[model samples]
Target: MFDFAIVGGGIVGLSTGMAIYNRFPNAKVVVIEKEETVAEHQTGHNSGVIHSGIYYKPGSFKACFSRQGSQSMKEFCQKYDIDHEICGKVIVATKQEEIPLLENLYKRGLENRLDIQRIGSVELKEIEPHVKGLGAIRVPQAGIVNYRQVSEKFASIIEEHGGEIRLNTKVEKIHEESTGVTIEITRGTIKAGLVINCAGLHSDRVAYAAGYKTDMKILPFRGEYYKLKPEKRYLVKHLIYPVPNPKFPFLGVHFTRMISGEVDAGPNAVLSFKREGYRKTDFSAKDLAEALTYSGLWKMAGKFAKEGFDEYIRSFSMKQFTKSLQELILEIKEDDLIPAPAGVRAQAIRNDGNMVDDFHIIMGKRTIHVCNAPSPAATASIEIGKEIVNRIPKQMNLKESKESVQIIK
Candidate 1:
């Protein structure tokens, strides 16, 4: 029996596998991914932003882990000779009414002990030449990195430490035995002393398979993006995010300069017909039926009906998407925006239609289920992995569970 079996080969899973190895050198660990390669879903499609942890509540997991993970992630990259940049990002306030919200965000940043500063329009113009904002909060710590490359490195390190990584392995069922759990995958069955379900989009389903009473469902929200035409790439210098809607979970449409130097704009959030749906036409009957029959989905729809409708409009209409971008950059026209690949966020929504704002991790008898880990998860992956490893019982540890966190920095 493997000491630990980790489902999902995304950044979180690979990170967990590496953390387990670092914590328990003699323990046999295995990572199973349904995809042909690691990080094929959420981690692969990551926006490549190293979140600054400024938006999360102070002392929250999102804030603390991101703060730590951002540093640790950069260290791992540097050690492995990966490409990364610490260029800053700005949250611009285009309207006077957004100033208060921006100020609140700045306060939250200070509470989280971030190196945040409020910049006036003059400073904002100095940073992003074409951007227009009355005021802004410049988060100097925020940067960008290719999370997919990081995930691959994590996989390599796990294997180097005697861990096995199984690819094209689809976990169909998980049965908890008295001593351990028997996981039934596409290839065969495997026994594991402990199972870590870091299944990004399919986490709830995987947990339910293990008989965990999950009161939530994973609702996939597709964030459609438009890449700036080559000639229009000059419109955005770095990342220019608009003041997000306080009521919503998604960061509103904005411009982001990727690590490859491609400028992308306007990833309007809309419901996906399938869990892994990347295209608007991609639909799954099972996924659609589950979403349609869910009371939580309806409740969420009812609450954000107007905003949801607007997102749908932007999803199909380039003009509507360009309009959202124009709120920050006036020179952006529909012609300058080209269709880019979309990413689906596995946002966990409670039965009451309330979205899970915090990280939802459930520890069962012999398994740990990561039910919900939304945005910034890539940025916080290393810290998240350490936390998961730390949660294991002392008796189960190969050495000592109380080992101090080894910082790569």
Candidate 2:
């Protein structure tokens, strides 16, 4: 029997595996991934922005882990010699009314204790010449990196430390009781002392199977992006974003300069047909049935009808997407945008129509289920894993080593 069985192979799962291995070096640990490789879901399809905890609530898990993860992630990258960049991102306010909202974000950044500065149009031009904004907040701590690379490196470290990572092994069901837990995978039954569910898009299903009642159901929101044409690649210097509307759940469509030197324009969040659906035609009967049956989704749609309508429009019409982008840069035309890959976020929404805004984790007898961890979860994976490891019972520690584990943030 393995000491610990981790469900999912995304950044969170792999990081959690590494954390457990670090704590109990001799203990047997195994990570089960349904897909063929790690980070092939949300972590793979992400925009690759290293968030600075600016938008998260102060004192929240998202803020704490994100801040700590930012530093620790950079450290891990440096130690392993991974390719990453600390290029700053700018939150721009193009409308006069948005100035106040931008200021509010700046205040939140201060509360989060981030290194940021509010600048005028002149200062903004000094960094991103092609970008336009009346006022903006420059978050110097924000950066970008391919999370897929990070997850792969984490798996390597886990194996080097005597952990097992099994891919292409879909977890069919989970049975947990007082005598540890039994995970039923496609291959065979694996008995584990503990189970950690980090199944990104399918996390809720896994949790429900493990006998955890969740008020919220996972809703798939597909964010479709467009890459800037080769000639217009110089349109963005760092990252150019429009001040977000406070009521909406998503950050408005904006421009992001990927670490690969390609400028991407998009990520308009719209309802998706399938949970992992990257294309329009991709559909899953089981995933779709759960979504339609959930009353919370309808309630959410009713509450944000206007935003939903706008998102649907942008999802189908390229002109509408360009129009939204026009708020940040006037020179961007419809022709400058091309079909970029899309990513679907597994946003957890409660029965009352309220989306779980913070990082949520539910602990059980021998299991820890990560029900809701999106967006900044990738950026904060390291710190979040550390926090999870700290929460594990001290009795799980088998090593006689007396070295104190440093817990930052």
**Candidate with the greatest TM-score versus the true structure:** 1
How does each model score on TM-score?
A: 0.97, 0.97
C-alpha lDDT of all candidate models, in order: 0.89, 0.87
- Which RMSD values do the candidates have, in order? 1.4, 1.7
Per-residue lDDT of 283-338 in model 1, one digit per residue for the tens?
A: 99999999999999999999999899999998888888888899999998888878
Model 2: lDDT to the true structure? 0.87
Clashes of each: 0, 0
lDDT of 2 by residue, 1-409 (tens): 9889999999999989888766676778999998888999899998998888988889999898888888888877777787888988999999899988999999999999999999999999898887778989998878888889999998998898788989899888889877678999898899998899999888899998898889998999999999999899888888888888899989989898888998889888887889999998999998889899999999998989999999989999999999999988889999998899999999999999989998889988888989999779999998878777777755554672244242122
lDDT at residue 142 of model 2 (Cα atoms): 82
Off by over 4 Å in 2: 395-397, 400-409
Pairs in clash, predicted candidate 2: none
Point to the candidate with the largest lDDT.
1
